[model samples]
Target: MNKTVSLDEIPYSPDSCERFEALRELPGAAFLDSSYPHSSSGRYDIMCAQPVACPEQPALAATETAWQQYFDELRRFHKDYYGTVQPASQDIPFCGGLLGALGYDGGNSLNQVSGAPPATRNSGGHLAAYNWAVVQDHLLQRAVMVAQPSMREADRNDVLSRLRSQRRVKHTEFQLGGKFESNFTESEYRSAFESVQSYIHAGDCYQVNLAQRFNAPFTGDPWTAYRQLRRTASAPFSAYLSFENNDVMMSLSPERFLSLHGNHVQTVPIKGTRPRYRDSGADRLAVEELKRSSKDRAENLMIVDLLRNDLGRSCIPGSIHVDALFEVQSFPTVHHLVSTISGELSPDRSAYELLRDSFPGGSITGAPKRRAMEIIAELEPDSREIYCGSVMYISADGRMDSNIAIRSLLCTDNDIRCWGGGGIVADSQWRQEYQETFDKVGKFLSVLEEMS
Candidate 1:
């Protein structure tokens, strides 16, 4: 196992111990926990990244060469386990880099974490970021996952209580910000129209997902906040993931990254969106409007087609099809038009290869995947990191599943940031697109403000 410890950086403490214990109870498991905290937010989250292949058996030898060999073996394991492989895509060259460099290599490890340098809060906003495709050269192909499936909620709660009791000072926390109804004042709508006109004229993109960040303070554990959001409004295939130090806590989302079972692979890409009214009747009307909106439907269809093409690359001959199209689904925040695409995998293929073919989902990137990605690189500020990318996991039996990393947070040593966006299309209104982003991030922002 690649155990990364930084004795000079931050010593392991009771909090880490509690999390480790909580996850250790699971069968055939491995753990990847982080301690990065969000500055000002004062919240840290711990993530149980993945489960090891064999928990009881003595681990494979640990040498530099051995590590490389282990990864090669894991690749085969994925192939044998999933029976399909992601196709090689020039669009996602960076997938390998992210996995190998930041994820598996010592890059993300604590031993390599400290004393090299310190970053100014938000100071690196202007720093040049690389595209995921380009970063592929830096990543390790296979990640080390620790699975501890036997840990119970009660056990975790006890550990939390113990840690809380041991704290010498009252801890700070985060809270929810309140909801907002933009109502699009008349002049504001006009401005939005103008923005769309400008975008159309520029030909920068046919569509853009617009959004706003909500600033708020949260008053307790970010993980608890995530649980509440999830429990209060659950979505099928929804996920709750935390990174070490609560730097990354996500209860996401309205999108699916990928799902594979018994040679059947599918992806549901959500695009078009509209707000839900608080009034029952109005909400119904709003949802109906969203379902029929030409702009929204068109956007959803485009993504569906994109997904079909992605699945086609890995599926058996004549096995690809669109299972669902333009279906409106309701989430806690908004209504979305989503489409599902599925295909029977080639018997010779494997899940790792399947993902290789379509890593960093197409929905977020847009049509002519590679071209769209290049556009995104020019437009977006930083590398998407986990945002827009998907969090993937494989079951012991080799069922592959992943979640699109939207409605998510990425934290380092001193800051936490979350990203949200909407798909833009030819007929899209810029202001409306912007509002969609706000609608998406509204809840998280409110909660953050509340905490503050």
Candidate 2:
């Protein structure tokens, strides 16, 4: 059954920006901040939960009909004010409120992707939380959401140390979280190269994203940990995903999958990558390498084409264009060559239509999306619940924004798992591609090890 509790019942001042942080400190309430500044509605949102019996996917899916019904009601309410408020169901993979209803117990769910238990629990990391069902109250008028606080405390250092120990035991561990080439194995690295070559030979797809997993435990205040990561990595658009039994956190990101500002919609796609260096000279060299690498360029351009096509579906005719291409943006651990694809959205299109057109991002899926998805499904045994999905915030005024789900963490009752990877094309060298994944995860793993 669905329940609703006003922000007033919590300790925080609902009107304050810090309401999210205050609510996060509340008892049995896990907070998810969409930070929907692009919308005309309210700013911060929340997702709260009280103890409830666990329900698996089948039982959980049964709520889909009701969820759609509730969403339709919301749409009707906003139709007069705004052309259409993006439905809650329209929020992609990491939709905040929907993730809460999906539950926070993360034990078996962790193994579902990693094939091994995670070091921590809470796996609803990147969600497409859609709607809120208020049993007794009128629907919320803004982009606000409600989630209860977590039942457990997540300590950073403890979690970090636990991950380090696990890595050692698994023999898959790399020192420095394998940020540089010095830490990873040649065999593992070569495997990625071989896969790229095989894919190329078979003509299955132009590029494919390959990733690996890392685990850790926790010992510090999780909210503090999130703030620290944000300071260190500081993504342009960021999100904090946490649940009662699990937490998924991220800090470094350079892509915007989609956004709805008033009636306008947009998406930014990133397609190339290079590791960052401490020395300015080294950094320049890495960016230079990324720019000059034909393989990377080809891979990036292919995705650009894919993104353009994806946006074209819901976008106004002749409005689609590559705003920026092959622009390198530097992060703490890596340098990435990204592209911006923009379009004037078709007035009749819905958020779900936009997502369906661009479900798995081009960077992750390759040139031809459906074919690449098929290959990915075959190569990977695990189901990508929310990794490639987008995390979005939709206002009551029909405005929204979302980020590509990458460099993210997932947690459940028993484990914590984070995934990172890069796109591989025909000329791709497997070793380099594999190492890139490690580099992407470096800082995250470092923090996790510190806690462990």
Candidate 3:
């Protein structure tokens, strides 16, 4: 059986970021910090440490069968509490991260998309590892200690006390040791852009998101870099994960891949983009221009339709509908056209099943999702790993929330890597699309430059 022990409330403070920084020192730590806490419906700031459970290997394939097997194993390991601690209408009871490359196995016919053989680097797995931990919910000022039924009360209290006592530390210094390199050169990217356009003209796919990876040798505190990233590009679904063996993930993602509350599921796909202007007037104009762009509207609508179809597979018939469309949301570095699609999940479906149907969000993959993945694989030089993967939380009672792993960074023993890209339609400009990728990642790149 599972256990939930409520402890003394941590003093609520606006500056939870400091507390989050302090919590990162713990093993297998993860934090989800909200950019707009007051407006958020669920727990805004959550910090979890010392995972009592985790998967032995990452879920690497995006195939439904693979995911089913992976989930089966995960459920097996946590059998004692598999169906306990039901969602309390407002509680999120688990913590985990979903790697982006899982899309490769999610029933897409991309087996022929060629690239260099998959890198042997252990960039964490493509699947999420759910762990029972001591979780701090800053919004409710509550600390929930989830442990095995056998864990003693005194131990739970000790863990809660340590979490309450954590405080922000002085930022550490990091150095970017060498010049960063892109996996694809400008000409090469342009060539890929043309290839995607040709596919569009051939009626193969309407839109395809093409991306390039950037990497540099580095040696520094990843936590410090994550702190800088938070300050530079505070996003609605920001996350930080520190694993054993020096592997780290820092995500400041603004897109919501999926969320499940009760049997209701929602996805917010982001399609359009415009760089934020420092000048107030210019910024207003940019937002207006994006709002009026027909091409962007079309781009967003196509994905909205795509997600509607994906959700329909698992949702009650006639229950799937668009909640919002072409809404412009501004982030620290860019403006985006975001749309919300929601549906009531079929009664028999579990959260994992919902994810299986919508493994990769449509906004990132483009219209006719399968064809886009094939093109992405054929053109991109390496496996995306976690770049476009998801960082998510799945509650024990089957609640879940996930973010498309955009505006993210990965750290290994010697190198730091990040990726940025946009969806390509026939009307998309190669140069502008190239610039958009940089614009999307500009602040993150700036942070790296400052550290270098």
Candidate 4:
């Protein structure tokens, strides 16, 4: 009923992006990238498209039961395709199931089961039950193409041929019309910061994340912009998703919201950040500063505790534990203090329930999630859309992984938008916090402008 073929004919390239370039033209093309030279946090690249079944919820089409309806559809798809499926071989992490984005609004709604006002804007989402995926396991130095159900031999041959073909597809080049413009000006951001401080002082919440959006006019292929961005902003959880509406979502997120393999679960939250510097000495100093900052450590601890409670809902009692805390991770443009928490999922729990119980990742939402979200909605000028959402894969074999979509860009209707933000706490300074947002996305904004 399933089909899988080794792609041994295709040469292994460290640059996974090159392998995905040709596949980008395929219908429903979606790439879950580990990038080239891969990050310490990632070891595989899963590229898939041509889903057998895919359910999508538009952002503007959200309702109280909208997220529930979408999940029901996803469950139906899984039951039909993956109810009796098997995982791919060669140590591949995914054998194909649900591959898509969950909108921020929708993810945020899950934790608001009681006494919360309806979301100002509902989250739109997508989950496709893909029968096949081209999986690259860098650690094993192997490549595999696995398809389930009826992938005819002819179809297999055609896909393999296209993959081995040279990368020469040309589309309109992506170029920004100008430098990006922010939704929050300096004064506006300052005012929001003061408001957050007021809430903290009033004991309304421990911390809240405030984000500002940036937009630039652009022309040409969205994939081109993603290609350019992956070189610099790429992280362990990076992804590029192409929609039929010609909408493109590019996520260079470094935060892992959740991962499930068998009954084991893990989540890594990133909280503290320091910008990268051109000078090696200055960069080292920044790393040391982040490692030593009491404010940063306290903020990280709050999110860790928040997630412990969230995961507890679906995890076996007393099985949850913090695997690591306050670990420093360096990326091309920033350094982060990341903490990992793991648990053994209750046998009665499904990955879907786990996701539902813990969506939109607490690191991005801050402590006391519901109240923090209320504060965010009151302050942020626009709906977050999919910016703080997730790009995930739930494999047929029951393995799952997702990224807290940050340092992300959404391109549509001749407009490109990206977001950057940080957690605000009692001790956080407004001006420095404002600049921190820029530090997170400075590379992405600058690179697009340079191309123009």
Best by TM-score: 4
TM-score of 4: 0.93
* lDDT (10s digit) by residue, model 4, range 16-111: 777788687788889998875847656899898777656665344345476766666666767665666655553877876788988787754554
True lDDT of residue 18, candidate 2: 41
For model 2, residues 250-274, the per-residue Cα lDDT tens digits are 4234567787654566777777777
Global CA lDDT of candidate 2, please? 0.51
Model 1 segments more than 4 A misplaced: 1-21, 24-74, 77-172, 175-220, 231-233, 242-246
Candidate 2 lowest-lDDT run of ten? 102-111
Mind giving the per-residue lDDT tens digits that candidate 3 earns over 11-122? 5556556656555666666777675343243356666665554455433433445555665565555444344564433644453222222323233412222232364344
lDDT comparison, 1 vs 4, better candidate = 4
True lDDT of residue 85, candidate 3:
60
| TM-scores for candidates 1 onward, in order | 0.61, 0.66, 0.89, 0.93
| Candidate structures ordered by lDDT, highest first | 4, 3, 2, 1
lDDT of 3 at 426: 80
Clashing pairs in 3: 58-125, 62-105, 62-106, 63-105, 63-106, 99-389, 100-389
The lDDT for every candidate, in the order shown, is: 0.47, 0.51, 0.72, 0.83
Candidate 3 C-alpha error for residue 342, in Å: 0.5
